[model samples]
Target: MANKNVIWCDEKTLQKDISGKIYVVTGANSGVGLETSKQLIKQGGHVIMACRRVDAGEEEAKAFGDLKGSYEVMKVDFADLQSVRNFAAKFKAKYDRLDGLMCNAGALFSGDQAQYTKDGIEMSIGVSYFGHFLLTELLLEQLKKSAPARVGILSSVGHAGNAKNRYKVHFEDINWKNRKYNGVDAYCEAKVAVNLYAMELGERLKGTGVSTASVHPGWARSNFGGSGVMMKVLRVFLYPFRNSITNSNEESAQTSLHVLLSEDAPQHSGAYFSQHSVLYRDKECRKGGWPMTSPNPHAKDMEAAHQLVKLSRQMVAL
Candidate 1:
C-alpha cells in the first residue's frame, strides 16, 4: 500500500542532467503537455512538440527561447490515422534516436453526440488510444536503439470507475456503434485502453531496454473537458472550488516527468503511478481517507491488458 501522506517532489528538484537526450511530447501547445516540455528543456533535453496545429505549436515553442535545449514543432493530428503515420515518418526521417515519448494529448466531449475520426473510429478512442498505439508502435525501433528509453501514457483517474457514471472498455462495442453513446463513458474507456496498452507494451519490451508506464495526472487546471456548453456551465459553477480541487498544470505534469526521466522509473516499468508514487489496489490503501494513489482493479488486470493489445493491433490494421 502506498502511504497516504506521500508528497510529490517538486520538478525543480530533479537533478538528472539529460543534456543530449531527445523527447517527444504530444499536444505540447498548452496545459500539462506544454509544461512537461518546458521541464524537459530546463533539464537540457531537446524536445519535439507533436501538435495538431503547427502554427500554434510554433508560436508556443517561441516561449522557450531562454531554455537550455532545443525544440521543434511537428504536426500530428491524432483524429486522423494518415496524419499519425505522416508524423511518425517525418520523425523517423529526421531523428535517429528517441529517448522518450509522452502520449499526452487527449480530449473529452461533454454532449451525447457521437463523433468519429477520419479513420471512422470513435473520436475519443481514435485519438486517445488508437492513435497513440500506432505512434508508439512505429517508434519502437528508435526507442530500442536509443536503449534505456521511456514511454509515458497520460491516463486519468476517471478510468478507475470513480466518476458519477462508471466505465469499462467494451471489447464488443469499443466504438459504441452497437449501444447508446455517452461521451464521458467513451473518454474513460479510451483512457482504460491507454493504460492497458502501456502495460502490454512494457511486457513486450522487457529486454529491449525500453520501458513504459501509465500515469494519472490528477484533476488539473487545464482547458480539457471544456468543449461543450454543458461543460462550460459546470466550469462556471465549480470555479470557486477549482483552486482547492484541482492541481496546477506544472504540478500535474510531475508524475509524467518522474516516469519519463527519473532514475527510479526503469524498475517500475508497466506500473501505474500518481503523485510520483506507484499505485496500489484500493483495498490496500489507507482505511479512512480516499486513496488517490490507488489504481482500480481493472487497470491491473493483465488478462484484459493483453486482450486490449491484440484488439488494438487489429483496429489499427498493424
Candidate 2:
C-alpha cells in the first residue's frame, strides 16, 4: 500500500522559491548534511553550515559551485556544551530569523571503553543528544519568533533496538560508570532519547509555529564511523554490496529536506518518518518517499518523554 502522506521531496516536488529563508545544518560538510545543505542552497535558501571543522565546511562549500542560495561556515563542537552555547549566541547575534535547524551531527565511538565529552557527559549522548538539546533551548525563542520555522532531528532506526534486546536510557547511570560500556548501546540510547525529545518539544511548541520531527535517513553512506581500523575493514568488506545495504547521501537527505521544506510537515510534528530501509534492507535506499513509521516503544511514553526533557533541562541548565 502506498502512503499518501509520503511526498517524494526531490528538486521536482520541492518547487517553493525560498529566497530569503535561513537554515542551519550541523555537520554540513559531509554525508546527509552536505546533501541537505546543497539541495537547500540550490533552491535559493541560505544555509549556515554549522560544523566542528570550519575549514572542512569551507572546502565543501567552495566545491558546491554556483548556487541559487548562499552559505557560510560556522564552528561548533557538539562534544562541548560551552561550544554549543557559543554557537547559539553567535547565530542569534548574526541572524534574526532561523527558518529551520537540522540537528544532523552525531558521534559513534567503538569498543567497550566509555568516552566522555569535554563536559563529562557520555560522548555519544553528549554529541548526539544533549548538545542539540541545549542548542535548541537557546534558540527556541528565535524559532518561535520566526514563526513557521522547523527543527529536524536526524535520528536512527537503531533506536528501535531488536527483538532480542530493547534499548532504554539508563537514567541512573547514563554515563556508564557502573556497568560495562558498549558504544553501540550508548548510541542507541541517544537516538531513542532524541525521538523522545522531539515528541516532547513538539508538544510544548504547539501553536508556536515551530514544529519538530525525528527522521531516519536510512543507513546512509556517510563518514559517521570515524576512520578507524574496523571501519576501514568493514568498508572494504561491504564495498561489493554497499549499494544494496546503504543509502546514498542524497537519498538519505530527503527525510531531512522533507521536514525542513515540505508544507505538510507541520501537521506531522513529533512523527517519525522512515525510508525503504525500514521495509526492505536488501533494497537500494532511494531518495524521498518517507512513510510515517513506528519508533521504539519508549518514544511514545509521555512520562518518559517529559522525564527526559526535565532531565535534559537540568543537565543543560535551561
Candidate 3:
C-alpha cells in the first residue's frame, strides 16, 4: 500500500549546484524525463537529452533556452540495440565523464498486437530493459571515472502488482515468445527487470563510488501508454478518480531528483525509492499510520537479479 499523505518535493526544493556535472536523460522530450531535465538544468547541470526523435528533442531543448544549465539532443532509439551502441559511442567521443544517467524512456501498449524489436525480443522488454542495460554497461567506465555517480531507472508500482493481478517475471518465457501476450503484464515484467538490474548494479558498484537505484515515480498524466485504444479505455475508466490519484509530471520527477541530488541518497544504494523514502521488501507502518513504501518480493530477490543479469548479457551478446 502507498501512503497517500506522503510529502512530495518539487523543483523549488532542489538547491544543489551541479555546475560542471554531465548527466544523461533518455526520453527527455516529454513527461517525467522532460521535467527532470528542466530541474537538472535549473540546478546548473549540463544535460544530454537522448531521444529517439532528434527533431522532437531539439524542439524540447528550446524550452530550456534561458535556464542556468544547457542541454544537447542526441538520437537514440532504444528499440534498436545498434542505436543504443551508437549513442554511447558518440557520447564517449565527446565527453569523458558521466555524473548521472536516468533511464527514463519506456513504452507501454504496443497497439492491438504484440511486437518485436529488430533483435527479435519483445518490444517492451527490449527497449525498457535490455536497451538501458547495454547503455549503462557501455558507459560504466565514464561513470566510474566520475566516481560518486548515480544511475536512476524509472520503474513503477505496477511492477509490484496490478489491481487484479500479481505480476511476476516469467523466466521461462521472458520474451513471451511461447506465452500469451498481455501488454500490461509485459510492461510489468519489464519494470521488474529494471528494478532487479538496478539492485544488482548497485551491489557490483558498492566500493566503486557509483550508486544505482530504482524509482517508482507514481502515476502521472502523460503519454506513457501512447494514444492506443487500451489507453483510451483506461483513461475513461479512471477519469473520475484521476485528479485525486494521478501526479503531475513535475511532481512525479521529484523522487528521481531526490535520488540524484539529495545528501541522503548514496547511503541507500541498491534500494527502491518512492515518495522520497526507501521502499523496503516488507510493508511497515509508521507511528502516524502512514504506509511505508514496500517493494515486491521479486524486486528484492538477489538470486533472481543475478540470473536476470546473466540472461540479459547473453541476450544482448555482451
Candidate 4:
C-alpha cells in the first residue's frame, strides 16, 4: 500500500505563511533545533529560541537577519528544574499566546554512572521527561490561548526493545537505587515516558486544539554522542556506520516543521510519526509494560503519568 498523500517538508522550501506566529524551540542554539528555527524564520514566523546559553542563542538568531520571523533569545536549561520554571514564567509573561513548542532537546551518554538532576531524579529522566513535563504544564494555559497549538517532541526509534531499556519502571525505585544505571538505556526510558505523557496530555487538551506529536529524526551527525576518550574511539571506529546511517541536520529538521505545520498533524494527535507520516508500532505497545503512546510493548500507565506529575512537583517544589 504505497500512500501518495504524504507531504514531506523540504528545508529549501522556506516559504510558509507563519508570520507573527509565536514559536518556541528548546535547545535552539545548535543542531536540528537551530536548523529548524532558521527555516521557520525564513518562512515568516516569530521564533523564540529557548536555550541554556542566551549568548549563543543571540548569535544564532542574528545570523538569519531581518528574520521574516522576528526572534528573541530566551534562557532555559532542561537539566535544572529551576531553570525550566524560570523559562516558563518568563515565557508566559512575554507571549500572549504560543503557536508551537518544539521539545527538540535531548542527549546521550556512554557510561553506567548514575547521574542525578537538581530535582534528584536520574539525569536522563530529569531533562528528557520531568523538565519538559513541568514546562509544558506551565505553558499549557498559553497553548490553550493559541488554540490549534502544537507540541512536537523529538523522539528516537531506539526506544524499541533493547536489553538495556527493558526495566519495568519500578515506580517504588525510580531513583535507580535498586537497579544499576545504564545511561543509554535510562535515556530510552525517559523518551518512552515522554510519549506516554503525550497521550495523557492529548486527552486533557482534546477540545482545545492543542496537539502533541513525537518525532524520530533518523540519526544525525551531531553532538549527540558526547566527546570523551572512550567515545572518541567509538566515534572514530564507528564513523563509517554513523555517518552512513545518520541523517544530516538539514534533512532531520524538516520532520519537526512538518509536524508543527502540517494539517495532518493536529488531527493525529497522541500518535508518533516520522518522515512525515503516521507510524504504527507492534501490538505489543498496547500491553501494559510501557506507558501509552509509546510504541513499546507496554500498557498505557495513566497512573504512572499522574505519579510522575506528583513526583515532579515535589522535586522542583513547584
Q: Write the per-residue lDDT of candidate 4 for residues 178-221, one digit (tens) a residue.
A: 88888877877777677667667777788898998777665555
lDDT of 2 by residue, 1-318 (tens): 223223357655477788999999999999999999998998899999999999999998897899899999999999999999999999999999998999999968878999999989999999999999999889898899898999988777777776566687788988899999999999988988888888899999999999999888877778989888888998899888667667778877888998998877888888777755643222332322354555457766778889998998888888
**Residue by residue across 98-197, what tens digits does model 3's lDDT show?**
9999999998855446788888889988888999999999999999999889999888776777334556668899878787798878988898898889
User: Number of the top candidate by TM-score?
Assistant: 2
Q: Kindly provide the TM-score of model 4 when superposed on the true structure, using C-alpha atoms.
A: 0.84
What tens digits encode model 1's per-residue C-alpha lDDT throughout 58-143? 88778777987889999999999889999999999999999999999999865588899998889998899999999999999999
Stretch of 10 with least lDDT, candidate 2: 279-288
lDDT of 4 at 288: 16
Clashing pairs in 1: none
Error of 3 at 290 (Å): 13
> What is the lDDT for 196 in model 3?
88
| Candidate 3, poorest ten consecutive residues by summed lDDT | 285-294
Per model, how many backbone clashes are there?
0, 0, 0, 9
Question: Candidate 3: deviation at residue 291, Å?
Answer: 12
**Candidate 4 error regions (>4 Å):** 1-7, 10-14, 163-168, 238-243, 275-295, 299-307, 310-318
- Error at 80, model 4, angstroms: 1.5
Better of 2 and 3 by lDDT: 2
